[model samples]
Target chain A: MSDTSLTIRRFADLANPTRFLALSARLLPWICWLTAALFGLGLFYALTSAGDYQQGETVRIMYVHVPSAWLAMMTYMVMTLSALGTLVWRHPLADVSARAAMPIGAAFTALALVTGSLWGKPMWGAWWVWDARLTSFFILFLMYLGLIALNRALEDPTRAARLSAILILLGFINIPIIKFSVDWWNTLHQPASVLRMGGSAIDGEFLRPLLLMAGAFTCLFLALHLGAMRNEILRRRVAALRRQAARGALTAGGPA
Target chain B: MSLDAPHIGFVLASYGAALAIILGLILWVLLDGRARRAEIRALEAAGIRRRSDRPVDDARAAGPAP
Candidate 1:
């Protein structure tokens, strides 16, 4: 077979929930270990690093806050791709992935809000602000909750997945808004520093630990996401078995 | 790193909240995975075969072949 078809075949094979479960089971432990190790190193570096000349010790909050924010957005982006897979490719695992990621993304978004508030209280002299960036992020959190609620409210699994995917695709508009809010409007929130078009404004001393923490957070998300997907697959399997058992009983009882 | 820094409460609170939420999420996912696995094991023990566990020749079989 040609390389392109071979690649497509391999990708198509993962649509088998059983194969995906086995693959995730093998990958999860290693991802968990890496998450733990990276978190350990990240925390150590974040704590021991020199205080910022301007922001002082409170700059330390950025270590945790920035990564959470990044992951919050990144997780949504993952869900968006998964949504595409669900709607366009009709991949079974796609809905599973998008559903699995919802809570994790919500938690991270909440973390970002809380930590950002904590950081803001001292730096911006307020616990909350109505700035574009902050408001956009809050909307993202609500969107996450809405997606979760939409999934649960619908009884039909396939229909629920389709509806949620459409919502996710629609909600993705907030992502770029959240990213560029600082630039588009004068806001208390700082503009993009690490992921700017020109270059990062953060000094190397702070950037190192910040990057380490980002890596740790990414690993944590992956580990948690994989675990959740595994559980979801098992859930479907159990449901199928129960349905089968009920059918067996009904059929066996009829007109013997 | 210094606990005595001014506004240290905010710093500690931020880290504390983040730690609590992140750790809680991790614990929840781990427990959920464990519970699901155990449930699957119990189902299998009761002779409810998983789709993957069935013989290849039974590919066309449905509803446990009752």
Candidate 2:
């Protein structure tokens, strides 16, 4: 654990069961408090301050809907990076980190789909569409589901890690397509407003709360992710010990 | 349309959905952490008890009795 090995040390800390448990003990409470405060403020802003000039009160939906959608995309990208880390660096935490992120990502993706649908019904006169943005997002959701299912189905942890990592990497291709689909083709889904060639399409009044809510959501994700990783590390350790005990019992009962 | 005038049900639904998902994730994390910690404590206790029994068993097996 020299200075040169600090990166390795950090990885080991994350990978080690007891170390992770100790670290998470100090982390979870702060994360929970920060997440609560941020969400509270963000909700207040969304409810009290934001109002759509054109879309009217309904525009408040954008605060939650937009941030969740952004997080959904961003979460996939993170999982992909973790997947690569697992493959190349053989970082033990990488697999558990990626696995821990799946359900959270899936939930965000689902929220995005549902909220987008609610928004669309009023704006587009329809609840569902096969438009490019929507379709690509649908693919993103399926990818999350696939990664989760793949992780659970394998018995060997390392084998499961490798397989799930590969799946996450492959599925990440959908993210860029989802982001750019609106511009590359004519789709019912609107083009990027908060981000654009010139500037945001949103006004200052609305943008402020939207940005705040997004920050809150990102913090919440980080907090939840650390907690989930702690649980995964503990579960892996328990499972390994049980396996070792079972093998010992078998060996002890063998013919002399 | 005025600021107050528009379909409001959709807005309510979006908020509801966000709340449901976030709360569910939080509950899952808390419950999982509690259960894993309990398991770890149990496993450690078992390991300690087993270790304590080992020396006694070894001494009896190596006893001087005929």
> If you superpose only chain B onto the true chain B, what TM-score does each candidate give?
0.77, 0.61
For A1-256, candidate 2 gives per-residue lDDT tens digits of 5786998777677766567778878987887788788888888878887566677788888999999999998888889889998999887788888999999999999999999999999988999999899999998998889888889999898999999988888887788899899999899987899988898988887888898899889988988899899889879767865765676577679966
lDDT of 1 by residue, A76-109 (tens): 9999999999999999999999999999999999
Off by over 4 Å in 2: A1-13, B1-4, B48-66
- Per-residue accuracy of model 1 over B28-51 as CA lDDT, tens digit each: 887887888788788778877756
- Give the distance in Å from residue B53's predicted Cα in candidate 1 to where it truly belongs: 1.9
For each candidate, the alpha-carbon lDDT, in order, equals 0.91, 0.85
Model 1: what is its DockQ? 0.78
Model 1, position B17, has a per-residue lDDT of 95
DockQ of each: 0.78, 0.43
Candidate 2 DockQ vs. native: 0.43
The clash count for each model shown is 0, 0
